[model samples]
Structure formats: structure tokens, C-alpha cells
Target: MNQLNRTTANIQTIRPIKVIQFGTGNFLRGFTDWIIDMLNEKTGFNADIQMVQVHGKRPATEVEKQEGLFHVITRGYQQGKIIDETRLITCVRGAVNPYLDYEGFLALGENPDLEWILSNTTEAGIYVDESDIDPSQPPASFPGKLTALLYRRYCKGGELLNKALHILPCELIEANGQKLKECVNAYADRWKLPDGFVAWHSRQVHYYNTLVDRIVPGYPSDEAAEIQQRLGYCDELMVVAEPFHFWAIEGPEYLKELFPTGQLGLNVLVVPDLAPYRTRKVRILNGAHTTIVPLAYLKGLRIVKEAVDDPFIGTFLQDALHSEIIPSMDMDPSGLEQFAQDVLDRFKNPFIRHQLSAIALNSVSKFRVRVLPSLIGYIRKEGKLPPCLITSLAALLVFYRGRYKGEPLPINDTEEVMAYFSDIWKSGEPYELVPRVLAMVPFWGLDLNQYPGLSNAVIREVRALLDEEKVWLV
Candidate 1:
């Protein structure tokens, strides 16, 4: 398959598109669709992909041109070995545009075989909208569109309310599908889509809150031309991903029988609770990521791979996770340490050169969510700031400077966080600036100015990290 260079290969067996995917991005094709193919291959429970673009006019038209054929290149450490694997993904039969093809969207419900609804429209995809009620051409919001399709299905199928589809949303938000269902129900009540119809949907559709983890670096434009030459075919939707993957769906135990990822060795799980899993990622993995970005990038590194590869920076990241983030977390420290180690290893994956600037996106919020709690928790527990974490905080503040050595640096973040910190930068000296920034009660959730030692510690470290380019013992 690698030598052939043919990006698209016809699946010898055609399974009806039983799963309606709300996203057609590289992440879905590489992560979820890849898992579905493996399930089909091993357990003979074949599922086909019917992708619905999340938004815009170009998406539906753009995806359809490819005839739903795409590639998934997994580049990372797999089972203790460095692996670079590519597959011609075949699960998607076609992508439908709800904007232009609403009847086509609703008509899928008429298919008795339809059982699953999967989505990874990113966190931004789910929104509450009060407009667009034409059953013939669904609305813009995912919940509204889904409700419209479902309502039309209810009318067509004599309201077989018990015929619920297992909907698993893979967005990163809390209670993803539950929130989505709430949005849909809001629309149902607002538009008066009917009492019985709402009952059927409420009863039948099993909306599972899911947690998915994977790093899908989609459409390698910089490497596309050379990659295409290597592959021999030009694929418009070719996506590259990490060897790691996870999908923890929160629902009844019986739901596992329907998804069946264990038999296939895929990391996808139907768990009773995702809190522990969420914390593991939030505190450990995401925590480490946020902690390292500024410290490593400001030290003249470009990507995560480099950040982890450099001895001083890498050791700082490892120490921060173990000494600070893990201890602060409620999960088993040993378990978190292992997970953090794996995350660091993944960061060093030579095949996938993950850009640090990409991770630097919205870093203020990233630090606030991923690193701040750990900082506060560890401070209360140990009575002082953690070692390398302080380094990251200092580095993060220094990073928002928008310049280093007179060269303009790219610092991507939400306007509010950026603007908030930007005001601090102009407040003057590096010493006073630290406290001024930390005083954002909403940012830190408390008066950081009150923490006398902690404020001074941050100021001292920020000046040191900027000077030495390393946070450890100088």
C-alpha cells in the first residue's frame, strides 16, 4: 500500500453508511473512522461513514468532490516501537450538506440499519440557535439540524420513539452529548415540534457523554507535495495523526456491546464515569503541555518535539508533572506519573513534529485551566511553589510579551486573556508586572497578590528564566 501511492482504494465490501458523522475533518477520518474500520475487519460489524459538514457552503461541496476517499497517517510510538503507518480510509461513502441537502439528511433515518451518530465538530461546533426550522433543509446549529432530521424521521417512521440511536459526541466540552441533547430539546420546546415527538426522541436517542484523545495534524500542506509524490496519488483530505487514541463514552455497561472496542484492541471504551479520565488529561497531559510551552518555546525552540528532546527543558517538564501536577491531582499519583510519562514520550515522537506555536494558541487560558489549579493546590499542600511549574508561569508571562530580543513573537490566545495580560506588560517593570498580572481574580480565582511568597517566587523565576533560558539550578 505504501509503495503504490494510490491514496484511494475501493473497499471490497460496501457496508451501508450506518453511522452518520457530524464532522468530516481529518481527525474523524483518522481517529473514529479508523477504529470503525478495525471493528469491521475484526468483528465483522461493519460501519460506513456519512459525514455531515459542521458549517459553511464550501465544506459539503469540497468534501463530495473527493468521493469520500481519504488517508490517515499515524506517526508516533506504537507498542514500544517507532511506527509510521498510513491507511486508505474507506468507511465514508459520501458527505451530505445539510444546508443544501436537508431531505437527504432526514432520509437517512428511513434506513432501518442506522444505529450510530458520531461527531467531532471540535468544541466550537455545538451552539444553541433559535432559527432555521424547515424540515426539508435543517438549520445551522448541530442540535437544531439533528432535531429537524429526527423530527422528520419521527413523522416518517410513525414516531418509533423506541428506535433510539446511540449518539456519542467526541468534543472536549463537559457533558458533550447531554448538552447537545439539551440544546435540541430547547429547540423542540421553543418551536413546539410536538409533545409525542419530543417524548420519542427523549426516550429513544441515547446521548452518551464521550471523552476522546488524539493528536490529529490534518492536511500537511507544507509536506503535501512531497508526500503526494511518495504516495503516488493526490488526496485532498489526507490527515496525519498520532499512534495514540482514546474514546471513553459515559453510559450504561450494556452500551459497550453496541460499540465493542475491547474485542478490537482499540482504546475506545464505554465507561460509567469519565471524571478520572478527564482529570488525568486535564491535570497531567494538558497540564504538562501548558507548563512546558512558554518555557521551551521562549528558550528558542519551535515545536513540542524539540521541547521534549532538549535535555534541560525535557527534564523540567518531567519534574513539573511529577512534583507539581500529579501531586495536586486527585487521581493515583503513580497512575498520573505513568500517563504524564506517556504524554512526554508522545511529545518526543520524531515522526510528528508538533509545532509549539500551535500549542501556544490561547496559552493564557491553557495555563489558567491546565496549570493554575495545580499551582494553587501544590502551594497549599507543600507551602511553596513547585519547581518547574513556576518556571512555566514566569515563561508564560514572559511569552505574552509579543517580542523577544526585539523580534516579534507570535502569541495566539483569546482576545480577553491576551488583552488582560497585554495591559500587565505595559504596567512597567518585570517585578511589579508579575503581581499586576496575577491580581486578575478571575484568571487565578483568588487574590494572587495576597500570596506574598508565591507572588515574589513568580517574579524572581520569571526574571531568572528569561536570563538563563533554563529554570533549574543555575
Candidate 2:
């Protein structure tokens, strides 16, 4: 079989590069780049991407070796059908690693066609690095590198509004685009860049807070042989993802004209605000995972599909989602219900082996951010504690005890979080444990014990869960 490249793939396009993407990872390739390719084909949005590697350790060797050509293999259940599709991606022009050639990386800023910047450097990518003051060298952080690039662009086109790039950060953090902008501004102030550049960035540049959803498992290692055989080529960059894809971009409606993804019946939404959508995803999808992980794992379930398939666990998840999580959010009830159902369906996707233990990592923080808001919201709305959420909270605390069925469970988290749980869990008594955990202001941002009857409910659930009593929340 031939290597997957432009020639072997019989692909040729010389579109102008309009995007400089940070992080040439699987998610971006399968989700963002795939969307761009669709836009180019369907809407005549003839724009190419120049992928820039943020991590300084190595260049984008695989992307370069394959000549920015790859395949996105979509294989999963969607709309009561198993959809298997493959598309050869051709929107990526090439790649550059700033660590190897800073000038080449900086040269991307000079491209006249460049109008947008996309990134998914993970949640930790957008931050201020006080040490990264020198702009002459490649900065150590994602925001620092982006700031350097924007400065280069600013220098090339002084006071030109069109030159300013629309930054779309796909990081999972809340207010991601705003956070990234703050980081860039912090760098500019620390490095003492020109006042004109700062003003230009503030006035012209647009940073869109975006929420991207797609499970890109990347490289189908187990089925690679069969897949490559069917495709009749060796694609080192083949990314496996689900059929369901959605991108909620918080921007002006004019973004529809700019990106035009929605024009082709794509699941992309350019809305005035992304709060509802963000809350919907975090509280429902992520919340379901965090809620199910501990309890399901304790029930001897390993993967998400198995947990969701189990009758008892399935009902528990659905009840928690529809009864508690969705009702708490201030959105269209029908829309929220549909999204919640979609989330449950995604969890039952057989093609994806989402491990419970994997989701259990940093579960303390996950619970606080993902589920706690809804739990409190339900209480405020109904004037009573949500039974399912409280049970999950107890299961979480019990799960952190780090043992189940006489075997040590894999509990991954920061040293501080782990130590805090370790110290609180030393006492075998549920009453003592519940109060201490609830008073953790640093974790939940408030004394969760303050909620009327919350401590008692949690204590009861904790005792039940610890005693190995089958106290199903639903």
C-alpha cells in the first residue's frame, strides 16, 4: 500500500492559508479540519490551514511526512443507524514547529490571507507565564506563542482592522476565548509591547468562546490493519471519531457568513451567547460521566457502554439527567431533554470504549464543576435536595476511599486533592466524613453543608453506599 499523501491520494488544491492552528493533534484534525474541509467543498469557503506545533520538543513530523493529507474515519451510531464514513482531508496546507524554526513560524503571521487562529492546547494552555517575557525566542506557553504571532501580524499590518485574527480556542475551560485574550494581553504588558499593538488587538481582534464536542479516539490501532486494507493505503494520520459532531461558537451572527458551516446542515451554531450550550454540555454530558463513573465502577462495571447498558445504572443516569440536571438549567426544556437523550445515546456508543477509571481521574474537581451546580440548582428550584445527585456525591466520596471489594481503586488527582480526601476519609464514620468534605470551600467554592438538609442527606447516602446496601438513587 502507498503512503497516504497528496499524490497517492490524488488530491491537489492551492487554497490560500487563512488559519494558523495550534496543536496538530487528533481532535483538531478529526473535528476542526474536517469541518473546514466540508466548508470548502460545500460552501466554497476555500481556506487552508497551516498547523503550528505549540510544544517545542518536536516538529509535526507525521503531518509533514504525509504532506498534510490524512483520513478521518467516522464509525459510530447516529440516528438509529451505524454510520461508517471516511473522507480524505485536504484543507491542511502544511505544518511548522516554532522550536525548530522560529522565523518560519513567525512568517505565518505575515500571511495576508490569515484571518483566524484556532487552538486546542488543552485547558492548561491558556495561562500567563511570567518567565516568558522575551519575545525574540519562542515562548514556553501556548498563549505566549500566540501573543508573539499576533505581535508579528500587528507589525506587518499596522492599524489595519482586517489584519486582526479571530481567535477560536477549543479549550474546555469556561470563557476560553476571553481567558486566552487575557493571557495574550498579560504577555503584551509584561513584555512591554507597543501601545498601538495593544489597542489594535483590543479593538479589532475577535476571540470567540467556543464549545466543540466530538469523541476523536485517534488512530484505530486495533482495527488499523483492516481499515487500511479497505482504504488501500497506509494512513499514519488516520483519526477515528464518532458520527455526531457539534460546535457552539459564541460570536456575532455574521460568523455564519465567515465560516458558513451551518449553511450545509452542519451541527455548528453561531449564537449570541454560549452559556446555555456550555452549561448544557458540562452539566449533562460531563455530569453524567462523573455521576456514573464511581457508582458504576463500584457495581463492577468497567466501560461506559456497559454501565449505560445495565438496567439499574441506565435508569439512574437517565433519572439524574432528565429529572435533576436538565430541570435546573434555564433553557428550552425540549432542547435540553433532546440534548440529554443524545448524551445518553453517546454514552451507549458501542464503538467507543470509554473506561470508567479514566473518567474517575480528578473526579473531585469534575464533580464540583460538572454536577454540583445542577445539584444546588435543583435544590433552589424544587426547594428539596435532588436524590440522584446527592447519591452520586456520596458514591464519589466513597470511591475516593481508594478501595472497593478488597482491591485498591485507581484514584488519580493532584497531591493536595488526594491528601485532602485521604485525611478526611481516615475516619470510618459517615457523619464525620460528610461534614468535613462538605465544608471544603476550596473544592466546592462554598460550604456545601450550608444547604438545608444537604449534610444529612449526603450522610445517609454515604452510610448506605459504605455499607454495601443497594440504595439506587433513581
Candidate 3:
């Protein structure tokens, strides 16, 4: 089979590069690049991407080898039926490693057609690195690199008005675009860059905080050969993702006309605020995952599909979401219900083997961020402990004991958390264990024992699980 490339794939039109993407990773390719490709084909948007390597000393070898051409295999359940679709993504014209070719990377900013900057450098990428003070050299952090690029653009454009670029950061962190801009400003202040450059960055440039959702399991090594054989080509950068995708961008209404993703019937939403959507996802999708994983794993379930397919565990998850999580959030009830249903359907996607143990990693922290808010909110509003949430907490503590049914559990957490659980479980008493765990301020930020009747409620469920070896459904 021929290697997947522009020529071999018969991609003719070389669109003007309008976007500079900061990570040549699977998630960006499967999500943003895919969307851009859609715009190019469906809307005549005629924009391509120039990917920049944000981290790692090595070059973007796979991108170079494939000539910035690859396929996205979207396999999952859609509308109650299994669907497998493949599309050759040709929006990425090429990639450049800033670490290797600093001049070439900076040259990207000089492009007159470039208007948007997109990034997904993980949550930790939006930070100021004081070490990246040298404008002559490539900066150490993502924001620093962006500052360098923007400064170049500012200089190239003669510091003119209305020359600002749209920065869309897809990092999972809250206020991602604001945080990235702050990092850039910090870099400028620390480096003593031109005052005009700072002014242009602040006044002209637009930074839109974005929320992106898509499960891109990149580079399916296990099924690579079969996939390549099926496609009749060898694609080094092939990315596998689910059929569902959403990009909620917090920006002005005019951005809709600029990006025009909504015009293509995509789930991309340009809203005045991303909070409700973010909260909806966090409470419904993430909260359900965090709440169900440990309990399902304890029930001898291995993967998410199996867990959700099981009648008892599935009902538990559904009740936990609709009854407790969704009701706590201040959102449209109809929209919330639909989102919850979509989440449950995504979990039941048979093509994706989402391991419970994978989701269980650092579950303590995950529970605090993902599940605890809704759990607390529901209690505050209803003036009673949510039975399913309390049971999940109880199951979490039991799971931390590190063994179930005489088999070792895939327990992964901070050493301090593991040690705390190990020391607490030494007593073999649920009544004593529940209060101590609830009072651990470092884990929960506040002593959860102070919540009215929360400790007692959790203790009851803990004792039931300890005695019965299963979640006692109330």
C-alpha cells in the first residue's frame, strides 16, 4: 500500500494557511483539524493548518513522513446504531518543530493570511516560564512561544490596528484562553518587550476560552495493521475517535460568521458564555464516570460498556445522574436530560473499550473535581443526602482498601492517599473508617464530616458494602 500523502491521497487544492496549531497530537487532529477539513470541503472555507510542536525535543516525524495527511477513524454508536466512518484529513498542510527550526516557526507569524491560533497543549501548558525571557530564542512554554510569534506578527504588521489574531485554546482548564493571555502578558512584562506590542496584544488580539469534547484514542497500535489494510494505505498519524464531538467557544456573536462551523450543522456552539455547557458536561458526563467507575469495578466489571450494560449498575448510574447530578445544576431541565442521555449512550458505545481501571486512576482527585460539587449541591438544595452518591463514596473507600474478592484492585492514587487508606483499613471497621476518611481535609479541601448527617449516611452505606460485598440499593 502507498503511504498516505497529499499526492497519493489526490488532495489538489493547497488552501492558504489561516490557522497556526500548537500541538501536532491526536486530539487536535481528530477534533480541530477534522472540523477545519469539514469547513474546507463543505463551506469552501479554504483554510489549512500549520502545526507547531509545543513540547518534546524531537521533530514531528509522523506529520512530516505522512506529509500532514492522515485519516480519522470514528467508531462508536450513533443514534442507537453502531457506525464506523473514516475520512482522510487534509487540512494540515505541514508541521514545523520550533525547537529544531526556530526561524521557520517564527516565520509562520509573518503569514498575512494567518488569523487564528489553536492549541491543546494539555492543562498544564498555560503557564508563564520566566526562563523563556529571550525573544531571540524559542521560548520554553506554550504561551512564551505564542508571545514570540505574536510579537513577530506585531512587528511584521508595523504594529498596526485591527491586526490581532483570534486565539482559541482548547485546554481542559477553566478560563483557558484568559489564562493563556495572562501567561503571554507575564512573559512580555518579564522580558521587557515593547510597550506597543503589549498594547496590540491586549487591545487587538482576541482570546476565546473554549471547551472541546471528543474521545480521540490516538494511534491505535493494536489495530494499526488492519486499519491500514482496510484504508489501502499506510498512515503513521492515524487517529481513532468517537462519532460524537462538540466545541463550545465563548466569544462574540460575530465569531459565528468568522468560523461558520455551526453553518455546517456541526455541534460547535459560539456562545456568550461557556459556563453552562461546561457545568453540564462536568456534572453529567464526568460526574457519572467518576461516580460509577469504582462501584462498577467493585462489581467485577472491567470496562465501561459492560458496566453500563449491566442492569443494576446501569440503573445506578442513570439514577445518580438524573436524580442527583442533573437536578443540582442550574440549567434547562430538557437540555440537561438530553445531555445526560447522550452521556449514557456514549458510555454504552461498544466499539470503545474504556477500561474502568483507566478511569480509576487518581480517582480521589477526580471525585473531588468532577463528582463532589454536584454531590454537595444536591445535598444543599434537597436537604438530604443523595442515596446513590453516598453509596458511590462508600464504594470509593472500599475500593481504596486495594483488594476486592481476594483479588488486587487497580488502585492508583497519590502515595499519601494510598498510605492513609492503608492505615485506616487496618482497623477493619466501617463505622470508624467513614468519619476519619470524611475528615481528611487535604483530600476534600474541607472536612466533609461537618456536612449535616453526611458522615452517618456514608457510614451506613460503607457498613452495608463491607458486610454484603455489594452496593445495597436503597
Candidate 4:
């Protein structure tokens, strides 16, 4: 079989490098790169990407070897149909590891056609690294590297108004673009960069907070040989993803024209504010995951699809989403319902075996972010505790006990969190544990016991869970 290279793959056309991507991960390839390739094929966008390695010391050898050619196989259920389609994505011109050749990485900023910067360097990637004070060398952080690159562009353009770049960071953190911009400004301040450069950056560069959703399970190692045989080529960088995708960008109206993925009938929305969308995702999609995991895992379910397919767990998830989570959201009811449906469909995807243990990692923090908002919101609106959410909370506490039905539960979290749960479970009293856990301010950031009837409701559910040995779906 031929290696999946430009020459072997018969990909002769090369587009201009208009996009500089920060991460060469599965998500970017399966989501952003796929979208760009569609735009190029469908809308005459005529653009390619230059990928930069952010964290790794080594280069993307597969990408470099293949000349940035790979296949994206989108497999899932959509609209009552099984969607399994593959596309050859050739939009990535090449990759550059900044750690290896900092000058070559910086040289990308000097490209006149470079108009956009996209990144998915994980949540922790967007931070202020105080050690990266020296601008002469490659900075230690993502923001620092971006600052150096932008400074080079600012210098090269010499006050040219068209030189400003549009930055869209797809990190899962809230207000990602604003946070990244803040980090870059902090870097400038720390390094004592010129006021003019800062002014140019503020005026010229556009940072848009974005929400991206897609399940890109990269490198199907088990199916690699079979997939290669089917395609009659060897592609080491092949990425597997679901058919559903969404990118909500909070930016000016001009962004619709600038990057017209929406025109391709893709779920790319340019909105004035991303707050409602973010809240919708948190309360519905993520809330469902966090709520279902503990109960389902306790019931001997291992994967997300298995949990969602089981009658009991599936009903619990649906009830929680429609009855508790969606009602708590402030968005349009119809829109919320549709989003919930989409989330359920994604969860039911058979191609992705999302591990319950993987989702259970850092579950304390996950609950605080994904489930607590809905719980608080429901209480605020209806003046009563949401039954499903409270029940899920009970399940979560029991799950933290680290043993379920004589089997060791896969509980992954901080040492402090683990020790706290371990110490509490030693008492072996649900009645006493419920209120005490609620009152711990370090865990919840506020005393959840302060909410009227909240602690009592949790205690009631916890008692039921301990005594009944099954989730009492409200």
C-alpha cells in the first residue's frame, strides 16, 4: 500500500497559508480542518493551515511525512440515519514545532496572507507564564509565543492596518478569547514590550470568544489496519469523529462574511453573546454526562452508549435534561429542547466508546461546573429542589465512596478531594455525611446547605440510594 503523502495521494493543488493553528490534535483535524476543507471545496475559500506544535518537544512526524495529508472519518447517527463518511483533508500545508525551530515558527507571522489564528491547546494552555519574560527566545507559554509572533508581524507590517489578525481560541475554558488576550497583555507587560505594540495589538487584532463542540476520538488503533486496507493507503494521522459539529463564535457581523462556514449549512453561528449558548451546553450536554455517569457506572455500565441505551439510565438522563436541566436554562424553550435532543443523539453514538471512568475523572469539579448551575437555577426559579439533580448529587456522593457493589470504582481526582471523601466515607452514615459535605465551602465554593430544603433533599436521596441499592429516579 502507498503511504498517504501528497504525491502518492495525487493532491497537487496548494492553497495559501491563511490560517495558523496552534494544536495538531484530533479535535482540530476532525473539526476545524474538516470545516476549512469544506469551505475550500464548496465556497472557493482558497485557504490552507500551518499547524504549530505548542507543548511537544518533537515535531508532528506523521503530518510532516505525509505532507499534511490525512483522512477524517465521521461516524455516528444523525436525523434517524447512520452517518459514516470519510473525507481526505488536505488543507494543512505543513507543521512547525516551535521548540525545534523558533525562527521558522516566528517567520509564519511574517506571512502577508496570514489573517487568522486558531488554537485548541487544551484548557490549561491559556495561562500567564511569568517565566517567559525574555522575548528574544521562544516564550514558554502559548500566549507568550503568540505575543512574540504578533510582535514580529506588527514590526514587519510597520503600522499597516491590514496586518491585524483575527484570533479564535477553541479552548474549553469560559471566555477563552478574552482570557487569552489578557494573557498576551500580561506577557507584554511582563516583558516590557512597547506601548505602541500593545496599542497595535489592541486596535488591530480581533479576539473572539468561541464555543466548539465535536467528539474527535483520534487514531483508531484497533481499526487502523482494517481502515488502511479499506482505503488502500497508510495514514497514521487519521482521525475519527462524530457527524455532528458546532462552532458558536461571539464576534462582529463581518465575521459571517470573513469565515462563511455557515453558508455551507454547517452549525457555525456568529452571535453577539456566547453566554446563553455556553449555559445551554453546560446545563444540558455536560449536565447530562455528569448526572448519568455515577448512577450508570454503579449499575455496571462502562461506556456512555451503553448507559444511554439502557432503559433505566436513559430514562433518568432524559428526565433530568427535559425536566430539570432545560427548564433551568434561560434560552428559548424550543431551542433548548432541540439542543437537548442533539446532545442525546451524540451520547447515543455507537462509534465512540466514551469510558465512564474517563468521564468520572475530576468529577467533583465537573459537578461544580456542569451540574451545580442547574441545581441552583432550578431552586431559584421554582423555590424547590430539582428532584433529578438532587438525586444525581446523592449518587455522586455515594460514588465517591470508591467502592460500588463490592467492586473498586474508578475514582480519579485530586489527593485532597480523595482524602476528604475517604475520611468521610469511613464514618459510614449517609444522614451525617449529606449535610457535612454540603457545608464544605472548599468543595462547593459556597455552603450549599444555606439553600432551603437543599440539604434535606440530598439526605433523603442519599438514604434511598444506600438502602435501596438502586437509583430512585424522581
Poorly placed runs, candidate 3 (over 4 Å): 158-161, 470-474
Q: By TM-score, highest first, what's the ranking?
A: 3, 4, 2, 1
What does candidate 2's lDDT look like per residue over 237-317, in tens digits? 999999889899999878888888877898999999888888888888899999889999888899999999999899999
Task: Report the candidate with higher TM-score, 1 versus 2.
Answer: 2
lDDT of 1 at 23: 82
Better of 3 and 4 by lDDT: 4
Expressed as tens digits, the lDDT of each residue in 1-474 for candidate 3 is 999887888878788999999998889999999999999989868899999999988988889888889999988887788878999998898889888999999989888888899999999889987677588998889998998988888888753456668999999999999999988888889889899888888888899999999999888899999999999999989999898899999999899989999779999999999998988888788889999998898888999999999999999998998899988777788998988888887897877899999999998998998998998999888888899999999899999999876679999999999999999999988878889999988998889988889999988887876766643432
Question: Which candidate, 1 or 4, would have the higher lDDT against the true structure?
Answer: 4
Alpha-carbon shift of residue 275 in model 3 (angstroms): 1.4
Cα error, candidate 1, residue 198 (Å): 1.0
The candidate scoring highest on TM-score is: 3
lDDT of 1 by residue, 60-123 (tens): 6546666676778888875478978888777777888776766777787776778899988779
lDDT of each: 0.79, 0.89, 0.89, 0.91
Which candidate tops lDDT? Answer: 4
Once fitted onto the true fold, the runs of candidate 2 whose alpha carbons sit more than 4 angstroms away are 158-164, 423-426, 469-474
Provide the lDDT at 160 for model 3: 42
Instruction: Note each model's CA RMSD in angstroms.
Output: 3.4, 2.9, 2.4, 2.6
